[model samples]
Target: MAIALNTLVEEAERYLNASRIQDYCPNGLQVEGRPQVSRIVSGVTASQALLDAAVEAEADVVLVHHGYFWKGEDPRVVGMKQRRLKTLLSHDISLLAYHLPLDVHPEVGNNVQLARQLDIVVEGPLDPENPRTVGLVGSLVEPMTASDFARKVRIVLGREPLLVEGPQMIRRVGWCTGGGQSYIDQAIAAGVDLYLTGEASEQTFHSARENGISFIAAGHHATERYGIQALGDYLARRFALEHLFIDCPNPV
Candidate 1:
């Protein structure tokens, strides 16, 4: 059974609490399509590949964690942007995206889903005083050497993570999904033995080494593949609509 396009968008907005969250891009229904939607295709990003896949799959709505019209991007619809928008417009496929909200959500959020994947017992927000912080403080089921934990990350993420090991075993941990290396100091302040994120900077190595906390930089795409799938499963069950998650692999 199909649902109205507006209903799907509204429910997603309410479920994600999108309006309350400040983000660099618009959160929901980036482009309007058919008045009704039956099948939804979700992905980590709204890349041309995903859009093409959605079209091939005959999806009515293309849902993603990253969407177009990001802040500071050239507002002109030309070149690549023009091609993407034209594809959606010509095919009558809606575009729906959620950035920070999808990262921070208590259920089906990227951070929380990643914790489950790695068996991290969540403690609390990485910074309790800051509502804007999307990272979380958590603990492992058992303490392991930093190297052992890094191996686990490699196994689960199917990519060799860059590890900066500290002298201590890892138990208490903090993490944010998708290019959140900048939060290392916040995790340090939270008294974590290790910190992990989707990407790392040169300074991240020094932070972990100098702070005596282990660090892992799992591939940004690998680390973030779960949350969008979880969200799609949830919406599918809720609305009795068909949902599919297509992963266009990114080595980075």
Candidate 2:
């Protein structure tokens, strides 16, 4: 069954509580296409490659976690942005994106989904003081050594994670998906044995080593892929619309 574009957007915004959170980009429909949408193609980022894939799939809508028009980015429709917008407009494919809302969602969030995949039992928010904190602090079903935990992450994520070993055994863990390495300080304050995130900076290694907290840098693309797919599946089931996940893999 086909759903109206506005209906789908409203449903997603309501489910994600988009209006409640302040995000870098707009959280709902970024581009409008046809009034009715029957098929959706979901992905991590709405890049040109993903858009091209959506066009090839004959998708009526393209749904993603990352969309265009960040806070400080150029507003002009030129270069890469122009090309991507052109592709969507020319093909009449709607672009629906969710940023912070997708990451913090309890059930289908990137952090929660990553934890479930890695067998972590969520305890609570990493920053309990902040109600809208995107990161989470949790524990494994069973404690494992720092190296062993890294191996498990590698297996589950299908990519080798960069590990900065700390404690012998990892009991309490804190994690946030996609370039959340800066949260290591919060994790250390929480007294977690390990901290995991998608990307790491030069100082991240020093922070982990000096603080005695194990760190793991899983691939950003790999870590974030699940949440969008989960959202797509939920939408498909909820609205009875066909959904397809297109994986355009990126090492970073």
List model 2 lDDT by residue over 5-91, tens digit each. 999999999999999999889889999999999999999999999999999999999999999889999899999999999999999
> All models: lDDT?
0.94, 0.93
Q: Please, what are the lDDT tens digits per residue for candidate 1 over residues 48-90?
A: 9999999999999999999999999999999999999999999
Candidate 2 Cα lDDT to native:
0.93
- TM-score per prediction, in order, is 0.98, 0.98
Candidate 2: segments with Cα more than 4 A from true spot: none
RMSD of 2: 0.8
Error of 1 at 251 (Å): 1.3
- lDDT measured at residue 191 in model 2 versus the true structure, 0 to 100: 92
Which ranges of candidate 1 are over 4 A from the true structure? Answer: none
Poorest lDDT segment (10 consecutive residues) of candidate 1: 219-228
Error of 1 at 147 (Å): 1.3
